[model samples]
Structure formats: C-alpha cells, structure tokens
Target: MKPEKLSDIKKELAGRTVQELTEICLRIAKYKKENKELLNYLLFDSDDPLLFSEKVKTFLEEDFKAMQKHYYHSTKSLRKILRIMNRYAKYTGNKQVEVEFSLWFCTNFLHYADLNTSHKPLQAIFIRQLEKISRLLPKLHEDLQFDYQGEFETLLHKADSQARWVSKSLYL
Candidate 1:
C-alpha cells in the first residue's frame, strides 16, 4: 500500500488532541523497534546531542573491542555498527553529530583493527566513510568545518599509512 505524503500526515497529526497524539505515538512505537528508538531519542536524548554521541562512542568502543579478528567476521560487525551510527545520526538530524560519529568510527577502526590485509573491502569501508565526511564538511559552519577538517586530514594521513589500498591524494 502507498503511504500518505508527509504533508498529509502532518495535517492529520495537527488535528490530533494531545492524548490522541500520545496514543498514536505509542501505537507506532509498538510496531517497530526503530520507531521506538526514534521516539525515545526525541523525547529524552534530543536535548543533549553531545552527551548522546558520547554514549554512542562508548558503546562503539565496546563493540570494536568485541570484533573478531577474521576479515569476513569483522567486516560484518563493522557494517552493523555503522548502521547503528547512521540511525543515531538520522535521529538527531545534525551534521556535527554525524561528523563526530564518523570521525570516531574511522579513528577506532584504524587503531583497533590491523588494516594490513592484502584485500580491499575493509579498507573500502574506511575510505567510503572518509569520503562521506568530506562531502559533509562544507555544509557545516566555518568554525566546525575548520575544527573537523584538521581531524579529517589527520585521519586521511593515518588511513593512507595503514592500508595499502587507500591513496591520500584521492581524498585530499
């Protein structure tokens, strides 16, 4: 079935009473885990995005420590962690948070894993995330962009040295 447009949904929601909206939100939250998570973030965690991101960083640190040494297994877990980070970024709708998560992910990826593998898929993940951050940097405010650019450049240099496949010039 086709879903209603966002405008139509907004209009209908605007007509809802406070109790009705709460009931609707509860029903939606019960239908999906992601819906529940988004609601939780909006209601509670939305006030302090920096704090939320720090909690995520701590969670990711544990996840990274748990990652398997095998390339195939590590790749699967890494992508799963990436999905979680993406979800948090989507919930916040904040560019700085996304960049923060991306940088943290890349830094831990390089530090925790030995990217010295002869193949390229994991290196590809690292490179893709860096590219994603580079694309986002321009959209941020000048001070934030400058602050993050230094970190990004540092990641670039580290990535270039770690994985044989990544070329520093491509991202620069």
Candidate 2:
C-alpha cells in the first residue's frame, strides 16, 4: 500500500469504535500471518537463505515505512499504541521499526544456512523481546478501552502464548 493510502487508513481507523479497531487489527494480523507463511515456504523450499532474507528485509522496510507515515497525533490512545510498538522494536535489538525487516531476514538466513546452532542466543534474545512486547498488548488495549478491549486482550494473550510455544519449540 502507498504511504498516502496507509495514512488514510490510519485516519479512518482513528474514527472507528474500539470494536471496529479490533476487527481491523485482527485483519492486519491475518495478513501478517499469511505473508509470513508464504515467506516460510519460500525460504524453506528454495534453500536460498540470502534471497529470502533480502525479500523479508524489503517487506519489513515497507511495513515500517507505512507505520511511520501514520505518526501518532495528540491523542493519548494513539500515542500509547505507537509507543508500545516502538518499545517492542527497540527491545528486539531494532533501532527502528524497519529493523524488523532486517532481523527477519537474518533469522531466515540463519535457519537456511544451518547457522541456527550458532544463532541460538540471538534468536532467544529476539523471542524474549517479542514476549515482553506481547505481554504489553493487554495493557495497551486496556488504555484504549474500546468495547472490545477484553477481546483484544484475549487476542494478545493468545499471541503471547503462541510466541512462548514457538520459543520453546525452537530451543527444544
């Protein structure tokens, strides 16, 4: 999506009820999951970590740019959301949201290159940071307090649980 389009989406989102916002967020999550699944297939099947990493990096860069285009306004709720995402990115050794692109790139590369053994520490660090961010989602939803806040919190918890499962699976 173009930056202008994303900005328009953000504006539209701002006017929505909490329930609407939660629905939109769920859609976004679905999109991300679908994209990630496709990426995984490409990475694992192609046996080309470097190429996969480059593609992931490009995708992440675009996503970060889109997020940046929607700079939070003078609203506490919007500010909190942006802050949470920013902190999450920082905790994951990402200086900017765009860094997720690079990190994912590196992760795929490591996995394909059989570098996982050597990169376990880095992977653990990333997962821990993601966990922290996942834990903060409920607080963020509470602060926003739309009618579906509870449902959003539940979603966040599920995401956290899934993250924990993935972390343990990777280690084991």
Please name the candidate that would achieve the greatest TM-score relative to the true structure.
1
lDDT by residue for model 2 over 1-172, one digit each (tens)?
6366888978887899999876765665577755445444444634543444455456444433333221122122323333444433343332222233323432432232222233344334345544443444344344433433344344334434533333333321
Please give the TM-score that candidate 1 achieves against the real structure.
Answer: 0.95
Q: Give the Cα error of residue 51 in candidate 1, in Å.
A: 1.3
Q: Residue 150 in candidate 2 has what lDDT?
A: 45
Range of the 10 consecutive residues with the lowest summed lDDT in candidate 2: 69-78
- Cα-lDDT of candidate 1: 0.90
Give the Cα-based TM-score of candidate 2 against the true structure. Answer: 0.23
Shift of residue 95 alpha carbon in model 1, Å? 0.8
Per-residue lDDT of candidate 1, residues 9-73 (tens digit)? 99999999999999999999999999999999999999999899999889888899999888888
Find the candidate with the highest lDDT and give its number: 1
Model 2 sits at a Cα RMSD from the real structure of 18.4
Q: What is the C-alpha lDDT of each candidate?
A: 0.90, 0.41
